[model samples]
Target: MPALDDLSLLIEAARRSGEIATSFTGKTAQRWDKPDDAGPVTEADLAVNAMLHQTLTAARPDYGWLSEESDDGTRRLGQRDLFIVDPIDGTRSFIEGSDTWSHSLAIARDGRITAAVVFLPMLDRLYAAAAGAGATLNGQSISVSDIATLPEATVLATKPVMEMQHWTKGDPGFKRAHRPSLAYRLGLVGQGRFDGMVTLRKSWEWDIAAGALIVTEAGGQCTDRTGQPLRFNNPDPRLNGVVAGGDAVHAALLSGLAQTQATP
Candidate 1:
């Protein structure tokens, strides 16, 4: 792994990219859709992507790049350092003029993310973490909530009304709160504002890598639907079933998800 100075450079680059994004918050801009129709991608996404790629590459020319807006190439797999980025994580929120969107940045070394930075420019919140250095939000340390039981915990989840029907069918005791972006939802958990977060559907690696590290460094746990730790730079880019929360709350949430999956 490289020194923390290198990681800090990545964080600085992300903050600069956030500033570029914030400058166009309400400006009239063109928007377009990706080929898959997965979601909308705006000009802002591309503009920030270009800015991040340029800045990061300039800082560390040897590091490989993996970004949402850039074409996928296996060249990054051969490099010791790689930058995993999502130019605009919550493009929907950004387009809708919502403040929940953010810019996510992470550096992976040998397939594990060693440093992370998520910047919510609208809210002026910056979440950052380096391996073994702990996580911080806007220069202040943050940790997850201490709720141990499902009935007592507040969950930040996505697509709950549509995709999480199984949970509601068997467990009426749990409560779910909706958040537009995975990055924002995970940030809420890292800040102790929410007790837990779960997602049943698949998501991109860039969407959760930085936030997952933040949650874990803040004394929380994050894993896939089957309660497995997350891995980056895999051949398959999709992530399935994210479960994250404080220690006891994470356990209870995973147990509930297990029961839901086992039923029928």
Candidate 2:
């Protein structure tokens, strides 16, 4: 099972993981929130996380593992390559019978993601990408839209992000939309279903690692809200936020973010 050369094993593992996740979808499973306020987790999450650990780690024994469902082991910081995963990206949406959740997976080497996969079981859409290999949705090549600039761009964001002030140009208006799953939002952007996506709140690496690469591989730009490049597998494994999509829209979002942050 040493298929970790590129995204081969990761993609394979993701498909299998998707099966595990789907088995629990719409089921009456155990659930609760974390004391750390890390949000909700269900028995499905634990089961899927265990399956991924068994399947992926057995294939890449040396690869470090960083998963939202797994405890952070400081020893992983010593590994050169790491697996970052979110067994179920939209737990809330999934529990509510929504179709936005997905199994998210990615590999990071030296803090840079090189391979990624996002599998939406209910939608039967699989988004995959590798460094220099480009991005694909359901085996079809994908790329971001050419649309640039806000107000005209169609974006996926929360209400707060929409209400925020824009730059000197004015309220960075855009056709605002919302999605519960951060990973799915990025996947949509990568698939050109949206012109771009943004969030002004802290996000987990497991939530964006795979999506970030998929967007970039699809010819989109991705970075923190501050416009800094995203790097994964850090000890904290949490970034401030994400602003990703087509080139012009990405720049516009970052510009607006800078202005809003500068507000008193």
Candidate 3:
């Protein structure tokens, strides 16, 4: 099937996942931390994950599955095509009644994401992209900002990423901000709402897979902290870190990060 066809499949699945998630809103949904301090999960996340797994795998049985809420096994490693999914990208935000949580989904073929969707249902913001087909927000085309320098950039990141330890020559002086959902942060960058986003901590494939494609299709760059291209569905299912932005700003961020390592 074509990438766009797969993108359509993901779009519908994400919207339906949104519907399932909202049903848990305004009510107390069971929430608990995962093993090894992996963060929280709620009843809504499981519900949405079950629906997406059943529906999507039914439509494409030949494909493999890798979902945040599902058990990780080597079965997916044997397949050429895989579904990478995050039922809810911001469970803490959802538990706190924030409307910014999102459903992140992607189709990866041979370690490359071919179709991707990051849907913020509460905000009614749907970001979709097919490899080489560009990106969209609610069916309208979207792209990253033209800002070429970090000092003039606005970035989405946690406060710790802005500390002096992360930069060699001191702060880069870009406006820094935070968003609970890593997927949403990437989508906002693709939509030109922010010039870039960075996270130096190891990241999960489900959290960054869809947004990585969205940023790339939107004429931006999405890579690890070392400026290496992102490849999904690895045996480990994790990345060194993430740094995404328009080309120039991406380069600047990587350069500074490399300097930090060389310092002290």
Best by TM-score: 3
Please write out the lDDT profile of model 1 over residues 35-104, one tens digit for every residue: 8676888888998999889988898899888888999977877888888899998888888888878889
Query: Model 1 clash pairs?
Result: none
RMSD of each: 2.8, 2.6, 2.2
How many residue pairs clash in each candidate at the backbone level?
0, 1, 0
Give the alpha-carbon lDDT of every model: 0.81, 0.85, 0.92
> What C-alpha lDDT, on a 0 to 100 scale, does residue 201 get in candidate 1?
71
Candidate 2 displacement at residue 236 in angstroms: 1.2
What are the TM-scores, per candidate, against the unseen true structure? 0.92, 0.93, 0.96
After superposing candidate 1, which stretches have Cα over 4 Å from the reference?
1-3, 25-27, 159-165, 258-264
Stretch of 10 with least lDDT, candidate 2: 255-264
C-alpha lDDT of candidate 1 relative to the true structure: 0.81
Give the Cα error of residue 156 in candidate 1, in Å.
Answer: 0.8
Tens digits of per-residue lDDT, candidate 3, 1-264, equal: 599999999999999999999988624889888999888999999999999999999999999999999999999999999999999998999999999899999999999999999999899999999998999999999999999898899999898788887887789879998899999999999999999999988899999999999999999999988888998889999888899999998888888874333111
TM-score of 2: 0.93
Which numbered prediction scores highest in lDDT against the true structure? Answer: 3
